[model samples]
Target: MFSRFVAWAKRNLPTRESMEANRWLRPVAHRVLEPSLWRFTRRSVPRGVALGMVTGILCPVAQVPLSAIFALPVRANIPVAALTTFITNPFTTPPLWVAAYWIGSRILHFGEGMGVEADAARGWMEWLFSEAGPSLVVGLTLITLVFAVVGYGASALGWRWWIVRKWRARAEARAA
Candidate 1:
């Protein structure tokens, strides 16, 4: 199921060859269109996910370009990195921000009552200024780091599992 999704996504993404034809991308084509950055190796995909998570969660607006920047240097799967930016869309950002503010307040000792007061306040900007602003920044940073780590670890584990599964299948076939 996931593999099918990945395949479809890969297909939908503009190929390196095509993207290079763009006047904007032409000058930097050598770096952006690096072959290793586009391949779907076990290592690249997870690193791409991590890079994407970092830029997507932290930058929000420039996630795609930021991911592309990081992916090029790290030789991560560029398409996967570009695609993973949607993790923080319009529907999901509000809740994540609220949760981050809450966690940040707790960590920074603004206390639960302050958090409640901030929440009940009229405007987000006002509530942010009262006490939660710094905490919110801290919380957002922490959350981005956590998500990036988790994404990278999960991909690594998945890659390892895939290798093991393939080995077992090959052994079974040979035995038969």
Candidate 2:
């Protein structure tokens, strides 16, 4: 399973050479193609996951590039960060936004005074501008932060678990 995942990742994810050849990234290719940022170390992977979560949730477009840009400063695993941005795609975005709007409304209580009738009278655009807009923004911000923290912690724990499992299997093989 892990080998399959590695194969898939290699086929799909961008390489250092591809990134370096990118017209937009060419100017900063030196920094972006740094060897340390590309390594799948314990420290870098979690940071990459966190950065990817943040960029994936907050950015509407160019999430891969954005994740890469964010990864530069943090010394994150660039490929992992770029791959993680797939969390927020076309199929998932609508539901995610709806949930964000719901959460934001619950937190802000923005709908307390405004009735459906009043909203209808004002028009959907007006209602969105007055109520839904801020709620969505706040909710998205909250979701992004939560995702980042959770992604980082989860990835770190997962990495540790994988390493331990591998060691245990190796020990069993040696004993046998």
Candidate 3:
């Protein structure tokens, strides 16, 4: 199942050549097409995962391009970074934001005066202008940082484990 999904992604996702030809990226096509950034090394893959998580969680718009650009500086795997941005799509965003708000409320001790329910009753503009605004911003920032750190650590550990497993499997096959 995972192999099929990977194959599908490879076939459907834009290629390096296609990206190079992109009108918007034409100015920096040379840098964007650098070979090192596209390689799937252990270091690059983990960096890409972290970068993707940060960009994906922090912003709802242009995450793929954002990750791709950031990946260049970090020498992260471009495709991995780009694909990871799907962590926050239309279907998952609402719930994620709600969770962020909940977390923010807890951390910031919101609703002490009139209560959270009363705050929710206010108009959208008023709510946004109130404590909810700072809470949401702080929550999103904290969530983004946490996700990036966790993503990086998990990917690094998973990559190391995969390599070790492959080595062991190869040794067993040779012995057989």
RMSD of each: 2.9, 2.0, 2.1
Worst window of 10 by summed lDDT in candidate 3: 111-120
Query: Which is the winner by TM-score between candidate 1 and candidate 2?
Result: 2
Instruction: State the local distance difference test value for candidate 1.
Output: 0.86
Q: Please say which candidate is ahead in lDDT: 1 or 3.
A: 3
lDDT of 2 by residue, 8-110 (tens): 9999888988877889878888898899999999999999999998899899999998898889888999998998998999899999999999999999898
* Candidate 2 segments exceeding 4 Å error: 1-5, 22-24
lDDT of 1 by residue, 1-176 (tens): 99998888868877887888899998899888888888889989999999889888889587898889888878789988888887999998999999989889888877555466556655877656866788889899999999999999998899999999999999999999
Give every collision pair in model 2. none
**Alpha carbon lDDT of residue 42, candidate 1?**
91
The prediction achieving the highest lDDT against the true structure is: 2
Ranking by lDDT: 2, 3, 1
Reference-based TM-score of each model: 0.86, 0.90, 0.90
Look at candidate 3 and tell me the lDDT of residue 155.
Answer: 98
Q: Per-residue lDDT for 27-114 in model 3, tens only? A: 9989999888888899999999999998898967999988998988889999999899999988988888888888887788887678
Count clashing residue pairs per candidate. 0, 0, 0
